[model samples]
Target chain A: MNEHSLTAEIIAILRKAPSVALFSHVSPDGDCLGSMLAIGLALESLGKTVTFFNPDPVPAGLTFLPGAERVQQVLPQPKPQTLVFVDCTDLRRVSLTPDYLRDSIVVNIDHHISNQRFGHFNWVDDQASACAEIVLSLINQLGVTINRDIATNLYTAIVTDSGCFQYSNTTANTHRLTAELIEVGLNLALIHHNIFDQKPLAQVKLLQAALNTLELRAGGRLAVMSLTLEDFQKSGAQQELSEGLVNHARSIQGVEVAVLLKEVGPQEIKIGLRSNLWLNVNEIAAQFGGGGHKRAAGCTLNVSLAEAKQGVCQAIEEGLEIGRDH
Target chain B: MNEHSLTAEIIAILRKAPSVALFSHVSPDGDCLGSMLAIGLALESLGKTVTFFNPDPVPAGLTFLPGAERVQQVLPQPKPQTLVFVDCTDLRRVSLTPDYLRDSIVVNIDHHISNQRFGHFNWVDDQASACAEIVLSLINQLGVTINRDIATNLYTAIVTDSGCFQYSNTTANTHRLTAELIEVGLNLALIHHNIFDQKPLAQVKLLQAALNTLELRAGGRLAVMSLTLEDFQKSGAQQELSEGLVNHARSIQGVEVAVLLKEVGPQEIKIGLRSNLWLNVNEIAAQFGGGGHKRAAGCTLNVSLAEAKQGVCQAIEEGLEIGRDH
Candidate 1:
């Protein structure tokens, strides 16, 4: 079926359901949480009983999102007959057992290319920069007026996933949808502040420690940065604060691949890989038994930080050599 | 007159002109350069002779912008009868004497609230997020099809001035205009790369040095970061490389006022100040013989770095205290 027809059918199914349980992916980001809350709020306005669930706690920076307090960590008792999964590639992404789908009429909405279509009714639009874009369309078709709260959630989702409209996934449709959200009286200044300007001092200290270890290799095509356990303890930063540090490496001029190695334990190191134009980091991560998208990926190694760094550097150099030959 | 009629009049004037000269403000930014180039390209398509002028050289990162090479730093030998000023608040902003306006039919196009309307024809739309927003409308009215080159320039202008659409000046119209530009077959991924991802390694080292001096005071409401002359020498970074170091201080959670002090010479320090919300940084800056907008301002201190930091801190604390009582 065409996208419009599928959307109509999903809307019909949602309208008829008496109650719905909305689930977001584990380690919920602004896209999943905002997508879930936006649709859940719309469903509630339609007089349907709605419950929101996420396997992990919302990140501290995103806790101010509208309806964020309603997202419970535990699964709802007496599971609703209808279930909606937002921004999830598959059921496992939500950390739920397959039994949850046994009797429920599952509806999946996502923008990931890897979505497995685990839902009885799936509306997967990989063209969308964020699943919230799809949810905005759904809300419009359901005849719900987008208020400030809904607009805030939808705008945050789009900005987060699209890197504030800097990513390749951002299309004309993304900006048009954002325009619509802005027209709904969204306080963009406050939203941008709440989402982006709340970095802790510890996070800055952690970044300082990370930058001190910056190294360039392979004719400046690969940039590497590492953070030892002592760096974390001295900076007083948690592991999650290490997020986005690899971007600093990837942003360097002429660098095709950027890697960040973090010592999580005495013998375990976490590796994050990012690429600019080419050189799929996912394939390199797969060699280490980990994987993600073409541009970003991650892996874990049961070795010391130095050993993991050496191994990843060798693998990345080989990959660059192959790319150059091609 | 209303905006539409004024725009129409300006279009009529441009359509009749034999030749045009475009001028950008000193220390040209993306909005000025992009706006000037977009209009110049459109006029060239219409078979009108066009020349571009800037008082300063284009920044290295922006050299890839379409028609960037054509921006001459010196005044044209034979000035065109029609002279256009883009993204300039006043005639002096172009670093040219008012004599240039003596005989020419001056056209002033800008979005700054302080624009002096120094042109026989002026279109200063303060509501515009970027001067390019106004230029886009003018190009459309001039019956010029937005090709990839023109679209690329206009998109850069909008993105840079809007802080990638994160700033408060961005409106529904900004995104709507950007959507039109994207539809013209612009390569957004490459544009984003050229504009944001080409950070020099020295800039990162400079950022590391600045972050090392990070300090929070006034109960975390004030964040101060300083970089000494020795820090610059150690990082091997120039003065301009300190452009965004203040932002690192501003992004910290609970920081209302963020300050960066860069020691340029013996007993000479440059001060950059940014406020997140309430405090009028412009007022504070004026008291120190410097002035700018409310949210961002700058000044130079003849005192030592320690004295500069102490004076600014005391002034900011008083400002914060006053804001609290209000």
Candidate 2:
């Protein structure tokens, strides 16, 4: 994330556009989905005909948000209007529906530093724990009604992406936002369960597969695993199953580092990384042209699954060394 | 629960006693442990000679609680002048040290309807979520410091035992207590993770094993599974790994009910029962002299493993029938 006055940029886009379609990365996560919905909700409250958009199925875990069902598939039929890309840094994230933004007024909002400024107006804050944080600030500036639903939705975005406010990226502003969100009557347990406890059978099957394949190294200080499509198919699982697997891997005893290499396709690997209390995973993610927060981050690598595992293990080793030296 | 006024009764015992020991039930869960420790902490804070006694090892998950390390194993020593059994409704719970309370001023504080009134002063309120809730009320009556650590500890106790406040037992008072605890800066994530997120390898392994054995029945509205000790041994998992395994079984799309029968010993079985949003598991647990809230409850049976499984499955079928009938 790189700092820019997102408020100024978003306001300029709103002034120039009459309607907007909001989109985030494919295979949307809580932060991505919640941020998209939170922004759409804000704009809707402002009397805009805003259409929330995404190409992939909203991961099952984040389905409870109030406006989640209205989040439509990003079909290229919203008429040449404003396309607000959220939580997506690179165009590849929206590859399936890249044309959705090709001829539209693009307003990009994200928190990944690797985000290329592909939009007509780009506002990426690498330091913010979640894009919802930026969106919250904009909502505050616009002075909209943040009812309990909106407050809970924003809280879900920030809390999940920030590892529930314990991650290093939890700036002072993060806690302050949490306080404000709770003030709006977000039942803490519902927010926690809607995002965490509600997992589909496929996700459970996938986690079982990952646990079966977990390889402990560094005398148990590191936990590594890879999930292939065959494993996914056999388990009847989905890619979203791999979402929190890395964190589970990281919880192993003495496992200061955890890595999960998910096979997107034969030669495509999406790496998810997590650490105990330390370990800078963002640097590792960036080595593969991806970027996220330090303690928990990820990247994508265009290599065979086997090769991707080797590269990530090497990167993890180097990251540990770099962390140790510093 | 039911507007308890046990403060005077408990204080009366303390007034006549120079030494006191607070013992919790065997196979202590968060509520049992929390009631033991929160009471122990409040007593220690009040300059009482209190020893937290237990018959089993503190379950691996709750070791993060403040007084966990201090919860000593019962040994041959002088008995306290006053003895308070926190969560034990039956004397068999603290049966490991039989004569330990024979002549001691035994006081039973519990929330179980089946409580046999096994002590001189029995404060049993079946309406309460747990004994910890009672202890928390007592702490409030005593006007203790209720510091962040204590509040956090008490909140964890209440949250875990109360199904994170989702169980039917949750009342305005429960919410009021929880709100006060959180308002006192009890970190919600800390409580959530301490009880739920932190899983051991064997537990994960047991989960995988349990899932492996999962089979849907009754038109997929019921799922059942088992965990043999052999499964735990293969995974290097402890008995504690059995926690939450049944919930996974119940979370399936068509599953209105779930049952997990874990072989605790050669013949004895520890059965876990869970139901979806529309089922009652408490009645099933009550058949075997155990009690829990609607969604989750369990009971142990000293029978052949096969018999235990059959008995539980039959009970679930009956419960499902009743649920359907309603």
Candidate 3:
């Protein structure tokens, strides 16, 4: 079915359902949490029983969203008439795939290019910078008024997903939508500060430790860094704190490929790879049974930190050499 | 004069002038450089001779601008028909006070709240997020068609000054103008990466050293970090790498006030202060014979680094105590 017809059918299903359960991916981010909460609140306003579900609590940085407190980790015993997933590329990514969810009608909404379309009704728009943007359209199709709270939630989703509109995914529509959201009395300063500026001391400590071990390779074309388990323990930082650390390596001038080896276990290490120019880190990561976008990708190795670092560096070197030949 | 009449008057002046010399503040940022270039290009398109002037060469990051290569550091011996200050808050900020400029008609265009209106004709609109936005208006007033190069320059000016539209200064007009700029074939990703993401390895090294010295004080409400000349030498980082280091301190959770001390000489230290909440660092900076906005400000001390740190910490502690009492 065409997108217009699919949107209309989804709206019809939502309106007729007496109760709806909204789910987002595990380890929920601002886009998923905000989009889910905004839709859940809108449905509740329409006199429909609505429940918000996530595999985990919202990230502390994003708990400032209006309905963030209502996000439940445990799905209610009785399933709702309609089960909707927001921002999940695949149903497996939602984390809580119980038998009950299978019995209920599934609706999938996402913006990821790799969406599996694993739903009875699927609406995926990779062109959208954030799933919250798609939800904005969904809310409009449902003929519900977007209150200030809803506007704030969706705005946070878009802003966070777009990296405050600095990311390449951000488009003219992104700015226009953000402009509309701003008109809804949202406090841009407070939101931007909470999401971007505020960071735990532990995270800064981790960043410092990571930067201390930074090494340049391939005549400064390849940059690599590693974080031992001891470093993490000393820093007292969560694994999530290392999320964007690889970007630091990739950001260095003259670096085409950046690799970060993070020891997650005695014999297990997770590797993050980022490319600034033409090198495809995704292909390299895919060789290790991992996959992601062309510029950013990851893989896990069950080996000592030194072995993992050596293996990844070799792979990156080979990749760069091949790219140069091409 | 009303803003409309002022704009019309400025347009008339630009049309009548056979030659125009454009100038921006010293140590030009993206906003000043972008604004100056856009206006200079627009005036040039009108078949008028335009000379762009700055005390220093354009910053490296902003050198990607189309006409940046033509920006002259030394002013030409002959004076132009009109002397226009693009983004200078005051005439003195332009860094050129030659006798020839003193006799020329000065047109001041700026968006700073503290602009002194020190010109024969002043056009200061603090409401505009960037001076480039006002230049866009001037281009429109002059009936000059905005080509791709002009749009890209103005877009970079707005994006940088508004912190890529994340700062509170970003408004609906900012987004609308950015959207228009994007329509003119502006590569948002390249501009954003150049301005924000791309950083030297030296900068990351400097950040690591700064974070190593991060200290929590006043019950973690005041966070402070300092970098001595030795740290600079060890890191092999330039002085400019410390530009946003104070923000690292401010980003710490529960940090109401953050301070960064950079030892420029044995007895000279420059201090940067950032406030997350109610404390006005500007007032604190004023006490140290410096000034800036309420949240972000700076000052320089000619005392030993230790003394400077002690004095600044005491001022911050007192400010916090007073704020709590109030």
TM-score of 3: 0.91
Candidate 1: tens digits of C-alpha lDDT, residues A1-326: 88788888999999999899999999899999999999999999999999999999988889989999999989888899999999999888999878879988899999999999999889999999999999999999999999888989999999999989988889999999999999998888788888889998888998999988999999999999999999999989999999998999999988999999999889889999999988999999999999998899999999999899999999999999999554
Clash pairs (backbone) in predicted model 3: none
The number of the candidate with the highest lDDT is: 1
Instruction: Give the runs in model 2 whose Cα sits over 4 Å from its true position.
Output: A1-198, A233-238, A286-289, A314-326, B1-5, B12-18, B75-77, B96-106, B119-127, B163-179, B182-198, B213-220, B224-230, B238-240, B259-273, B277-326
State the lDDT of candidate 3 residue by residue for B65-85, as single tens digits: 879998998886587768899
lDDT of 3 at B38: 94
Decide which is better by DockQ, 1 or 3: 1
Best candidate, TM-score: 1
Separate clash counts for every candidate: 0, 6, 0
- Candidate 2 chain B weakest ten by summed lDDT: B1-10
Writing each residue's lDDT as its tens digit, candidate 3 over A1-326 gives 99889999999999999999898988788899999999998998899988888888788788889988988999865877799989998767877545656678889999999998888899999999999889999998899988888998999999889988888888888878777777778888888778876788888888888888999998899989899999899989878889898888888887889888899889999999998767888899998899898989999999899988888888888887777565
What are the TM-scores, per candidate, against the unseen true structure? 0.93, 0.67, 0.91
Please tell me what DockQ candidate 1 reaches.
0.80
**DockQ of all models, two decimals each:** 0.80, 0.16, 0.67
Per-residue C-alpha lDDT of model 2 across residues A1-326, encoded as one tens digit per residue: 22446556678677556677777777788898888888888888777888876778776677788788888775546464788888998888866446646667788888898888888778878989888888888788777878877887888888788875545465546656665676676667556546655656677678777777878776666789889988888878767656777877776555678899999887889888887656788877888899887767888888898899888898787767676665
TM-score of 1: 0.93
Ranking by TM-score: 1, 3, 2
**lDDT by residue (tens digit), candidate 2, B147-236:** 776776777777677775555465445555655665666655546556765667667678778877877787777788998879978989
> Once model 3 is optimally superposed onto the true structure by TM-score, how far is the C-alpha of residue A5 displaced, in angstroms?
3.4
